[model samples]
Target chain A: MRVHELETPAVLIDLDVMERNLARMAEYCRRHGLALRPHTKTHKIPELAHRQMASGASGITVAKLGEAEVMIQAGLTDVLIAYPIVGREKAARLAALAERASLTVALDSEEAVRDISRSAQERGVRLGLLVELDIGFRRCGVQRPDEAVALARLIHDLPNVDFRGVMFYPGHFMAPEPERRQLLEDANTRLRRFYDAFERAGLSIGVVSGGSTPTAFISHEFLGVTEIRPGMYIFNDRTMVGLGVARPEDCALSILVTVVSTSVSGRAIVDGGSKTFSTDRYRAGDGRGFGLVCEDPEAEVEALSEEHGHLDISRSSRRYRVGERLRIIPNHVCTVMNLHDEVYGIRGDQVEAVWRVAARGRVR
Target chain B: MRVHELETPAVLIDLDVMERNLARMAEYCRRHGLALRPHTKTHKIPELAHRQMASGASGITVAKLGEAEVMIQAGLTDVLIAYPIVGREKAARLAALAERASLTVALDSEEAVRDISRSAQERGVRLGLLVELDIGFRRCGVQRPDEAVALARLIHDLPNVDFRGVMFYPGHFMAPEPERRQLLEDANTRLRRFYDAFERAGLSIGVVSGGSTPTAFISHEFLGVTEIRPGMYIFNDRTMVGLGVARPEDCALSILVTVVSTSVSGRAIVDGGSKTFSTDRYRAGDGRGFGLVCEDPEAEVEALSEEHGHLDISRSSRRYRVGERLRIIPNHVCTVMNLHDEVYGIRGDQVEAVWRVAARGRVR
Candidate 1:
């Protein structure tokens, strides 16, 4: 069925466009001699993971175990879990995952290495681990080279865990006119220093990984980085747009919403709301709630009830009446895609196929 | 199985307590002489809806057409959609739903009345409509009594649409206690006046519905209201707690999460993140995020990533450590329950059943 006939608030992804988008990134990675490991957390579709593998990606990176499991089951063998598996439950799960494929998990602590090793040895599987050194985005990962060396040493000494490489994400460095050279040099120094420390301690550093979508453009100049994991580049978003990584049309996914009401002369309401766009409002210089345009630049999703999207439309946008549709490129595409069960592959106006969001509600 | 044996970041409901909660609400409505029309949007489980009906509820209220369809398929004969459905796609679905069961829809405009009438005319059954009046939420519904009268007139004049009654929400009025009486009075008076206008215009004003867990406490005082549509009273949350509506123990739903990590002697991380507690972080007063401490009242869910819940514990909660299980009462139970596909029913510490959240993603 066509997208319009399907329903409002449904996720539409043009398969032909998505493939081109996927192929475009794949081509870029190949041209740059970079091993492409697209993050599966962006789409969470096992089919997309398989497609990415077929398009010549060296491996795939998943944010959560639930995503890793889905991709592994779909026959995309090489998987990198780019998050710390800290708890006993997850450690045990990661051990099982390691047995299924060439699994590499990121760790930022000696305790994590010990806990993961306990599970890995029990399962008779060796887990390849990366020391996540922080370049920016101070969420997870070891901050200092000394901490990285200690964690790497611990992983290297573990019974069933191997220290593959050191990873760092210069997420905050993804500037539009990226301070490309300085950021790359900084990342190289941090990673190489950490990697060298492990080597000095009589350890082999095999993999060096980092960089997200915004910083992906300068992947060739990555210092001491053997590989990069750039996920959002597959389906660019307003976040990418704001970072000047990709243009609006480059985004493969969009929420196709129909005008649900137009009773008020100049005010029209769409069928999508917080349940669709979510509460991730990106002001990106001057955009309103999420990616929606409003009269005032500082437009918050000003007000969102459960089912209604209260957009304070600009005067020109208000002129657009009921029954029309608008394509909303979300600030964070991953979160928006996670909210739906399926996304349509749209070729122009034709809905080529509906792909099941196989990993939906896989929040573990 | 024990609750701890289950995966981290899972939805949990105390079945015994939920049954008790249902009976309590049903009993209160009965004693107060009001027809209980529980909004199924909170739970969206047919089993719960059936239990609600069995416990003396007159009917179920759904927020979307997909929800109504699911309820009808589950043998719920009478359902009221508390959302304004306006498009051809949804209108057609609503008409088809009317053919399956006794359906009532909320409408706030003459255009919506025309659309519903058109859809109803296509089907053999007449559409039951409730004129929604604005009671200060200022989100949807007609502003004044006369505007509601105009819509009522439109519905009454239509051949296939029946003007059922007046429906409005005093959701904003549900502010603990001091302002609730005044808000309730003001909203009910406006609604009753519209009901009178409908009556004077010879239109049937069968149901006068209003809602909220906070205001539902004083529902007995709302004599003109025909039915009450309180949703979250079953799974009382932080919002209810903040409004002084219900105490902590009264909450039936909670997220069962495992502590995944601990940062030295400082912060502890859980598997429950935005995906589990959901990204619905509306701080009531000064609370940082969307959940309350299940064990310690002073602690609140401070931050959440897509897959990590960063709970900021007070200095008193220092005893909480890694590998321990904690129950979290979400800030908004309706949104949290909607985020998951299933919820485990627990009795004491044993997981008795795993109920699929069948109508979980019917946000359309």
Candidate 2:
């Protein structure tokens, strides 16, 4: 649908720009000699995964087994689940998925390793599992080097299981820090220590994966990493701009919304609300609220209701009268795209294609 | 699925409890001699709408044309779209829905009225339009009674359109307060003035509708209003408990979540993240966070990541271990249910039935 003629609060993806972004990231990985596994959790659409593969991605990375299942059904064979799997039902699901495709799972704890091993033995399938190590963020993963070594030893000793390499997420390194030599050297030291422990355990690790979007930009010298998974590079959002990674023109996906009314301090209320933008709050240091106004970069959407997005478009000299359509670049692209069923892929204001978010509600 | 066997972070709706809640609202409306037009936007499944009709609801209300289309396709005959129709696509869609169903639409401006009137006239159907007056919340609707009258006059002057009545929403009054009487009275004053203006404009106003969950629990006497549309009472949430409108036990919908990890203090990470419990946040003076910690009313969920829900889960001497499940009353019940493609309706721990959120992704 045309932007001016269609309804407000619809998700829009620029197809030409997105193809360029996919190619740029793929070429970056090729030039740096890093295996590219774009996270399907970001776009969660099979077509986008196919596009990433066509652009030279080695495989797909997912956050959940259900997401991996969708990719497998869509002909994406090599898949990596970046989440630790526990529970009898979940392990069975993982084992079943491993039977169809090359599945590698993450294990962060002793309990997880034992559980996964037991499930793999019961299913009579050799499960490929990675021991997760936390470099920072303090969310998941083993912090101690000895613990990582022990996890790898346990998984290797168990029946019907193969111990893959370690996985560490250095999310804290993505803050656009002033690249001190100490920070770089310290990250290398930790990685070296972990790999040394794995070597001492007499285990041959298959893949040593680490780095996110912001971290992968400087990952060429991260020393001991084999693969990099950067999902949001294909659809840079306001958060990327806030973190100083990408520019506004680099944002590939934007919400096509209309100005429903202009009232209350010239505030134009759009039809998008928390349901569309999500309730994610980001501290960009400037204290701008909700999401970044895309059509007008300086404009701010200070508040959101369930069905109403409020924007402070009062000060712009541009005339945005009622029924005017505007595009919004959300702060967090992954979460916002996850909230929609399908997004229109526009090529210079023409609706070229519609991509169904294949794994939109695969939260299991 | 059985409550104990089903995966954590899944939504569970007890059919028996939901029926009781639905009966309670219907009985209250019957006693008050008021028409109950339950808004189906809460649970977009048409089966629930059919059950509501079987229990004596005058009609069901929808938030968007996409949702209305889904319900109508499921054989629902009458629907009231409680939001304005502003675009060509939406107006045309609304007119198409009018052919087979008795549709009542809310309009607060002449532009929307003329848009709907033009489409409905072309389709040879008279569209029923309600003049939405602002009572509070400052979102949509005409600001004053005279503006509502002017809008009604314009709607009546247009061909193939009927002025249904004045619709005013007191959403800000949904917060619990001792001054609830003043809030309701203030809302009534504006609505009564609008009703008089409609009469002075020689309009045949049919339905005066207004009510949210908080206002539904109290006296819903809006001067000359004939109907009240409250959707969340069927599945109460923590927002209801926080507002002192409903007790925790009344929350029939909950996210059955498993404690995935334990780090320090009484903190535990649940499998439910913003994807499941949603990211809606509202606090009372006591400073309640995302949700009220079940079994420990004093505790709250302090933080949330993409796939992790952080909870300060204990206020007593009992320690919370990993693998334990906690039932989470979400901040907003409506949005939480919408996130899921389907919900399990159970009784105690037994699996009874599954309901498809037929219009979950119908956010046009």
Candidate 3:
């Protein structure tokens, strides 16, 4: 089927561009001697994860246990839960997953370590553990190098847990080249402190995993990092374009919407809104609109209600009519992917495949 | 099962509070001599819509045609899709739905009217139509009162279409009482223009629909409104609390999440983030946090990544540990509901039932 024949508010993936993205990332990692473990949190599709593995990914990384379960059900053997596993229920789920796959988890707290260790011990499974460090992005992870070493030593000594290495998210350095390079260097210096402390403590930290979509290309500059987990590189977004990491054409995903109302003088309303594109601000850009209108550079999704994408067409010379279809590039693709159940993979105007976002809303 | 036993990042709806909310709105609309058509876009659950209907709602309102389909399949006979139906595909879908249900749609443009009319005629179904007016919320609708009258006359003259009336959304008047009253009166005066124009045009204008959660109680002040559509009243959110329309105790919906990391001195990370709670800003409140932590008044979800909710516990005297569960009242309940598959309806600590968010991602 043709793309234009599909329903409005449908998410479309340019298969050619996506394949290019997959090959480019794989080639980059291969040349750099870095293991690529693409995070499935962005796409949340088992088919895409399988394709990533086929394209040279060592394993898959997921944010939640439910997502890991979905991927494992699709026959993925090597998996990593990159987020901390807390509580007995989640620990038990993680341990059950470990029974089927070569499982690894990253955590920063001793409490998380105890929870997962107890479940792993009960299930007779050895789980690979990575200590998470808050190099600069202070959302999660241990704040100090001493804290990382303490967690590493504790994980190494724990039964049924193998001390894998360390993981950190450099999500804050999405600025231009010079500034981003400086921030990565600063973070790399701080990351070396944890590695140096582990060496002094006579520990072998085998896997140093750290990378984000913006910093994936500069992984070689990340000091002793052995692997990278970049999720959004598969189908880049407006944020990636704003960060200068990807071009507008590199964004493989776009939300197709039909203009529903054009009665308001300067504004046109589309069928998709915050529920379709989400209210994620374009903080990486000028922080003005919700998404970029692919049809017109001057037009932007100025605002959104639950089901209305308010397009500000005041600056655009072209007038929008009701029933006119337009494609929008959302500011954040991950959240948009989670909002939908399926996405269409297209080559030109032809629909090549329809992939279910199988793990969508698997927030547990 | 108990609420605490449920997995982390689960959406919870307090049945007791929700029932009370239903009763209160029913009573208020009864006393005001107005029909209450609660918008189902907030919960997106068929059971909740049934409960609202049982509580004296005239019908259920939805934001999209797909949502209308979900409600119709659940045996709902009356539905008003309070969104424009553009394109032949959506018009055809709406026409098919009208065959089974008493369907009404709101539109503001001639193109929309033509599209829906063509499909309704083809399907041999009479679809009710309402001319949407822009009553200060510059989202969707005709900007002028004359435009509304013109659309109403056009609909009245069209075949296979019944001109219901006019629908306006006063969504921007969510301030404190005095300020909100003033704004409502201002909108009322503006709304009078459309009714007077209709009267001059010899239009009956039977069903005048208008209202939002923040302006539902004061909907009587909307000069000629006969029915009100309030979506978020049943599951009041932090935004309603910030607007002073609903108290914190009145909020029926919340997200249950576990503290996954507290290694940082003043920040604690929870399992739910933008994917769980959404990136909707608390625009009605101080706009400082993503959501309000119900345990401590001072603590707030300061930020969010894709899978991590960063809690700012710096102002509070509470010490958070890993595996600790926290309930968060999201800033906007509608978007949060769209993020989950099922919500646990609870009575105190006990989980009463689980309802699928039937129209969760029906953004089309």
Pick by lDDT: which candidate is best?
Answer: 3
| Candidate order, DockQ descending | 3, 2, 1
lDDT of 1 by residue, A1-364 (tens): 6666767878878666578778887888788778888888788888888888899889999878888888888887899988777677788998998888999988676667888999999999998898887664454567666777777777767799888887766755745464656767776776667666776777677888876787786777776666788887778877777767777668788877666554434355667766677666452555545664423333334555567766555344335445567766777877777778888877877888788888877877
Q: What is the C-alpha RMSD of each candidate to the true structure, in Å?
A: 3.3, 2.6, 1.3
- Tens-digit per-residue lDDT, B106-223, candidate 1: 8776666787888888876788899887776666677766777788878878888888888877757745477777777776676667667766867777888877677786876764
Q: What is the DockQ of each candidate?
A: 0.40, 0.42, 0.88
- Report fnat in order of the candidates: 0.31, 0.25, 0.99
Candidate 2 lDDT over A179-292, as tens digits, reads 534566777887788888878877788787876787767778887678888888888887777777788788888888876665344577788888898877763546467777
User: Model 1: runs farther than 4 Å from truth?
Assistant: A15-20, A86-92, A109-111, A169-193, A218-223, A263-267, A286-288, A293-301, A314-317, A320-322, B174-182, B185-189, B220-223, B263-265, B295-300, B313-321
Off by over 4 Å in 2: A1-8, A173-193, A199-204, A221-223, A263-265, B179-182, B219-221, B263-267, B285-288, B293-299, B313-322
What is residue A124's positional error in candidate 3, in angstroms? 1.5
TM-score of each: 0.91, 0.94, 0.98
Candidate 1: which pairs clash? A14-A346, A289-A301
Categorize the docking of model 2: acceptable
Sort all candidates by TM-score, best to worst: 3, 2, 1
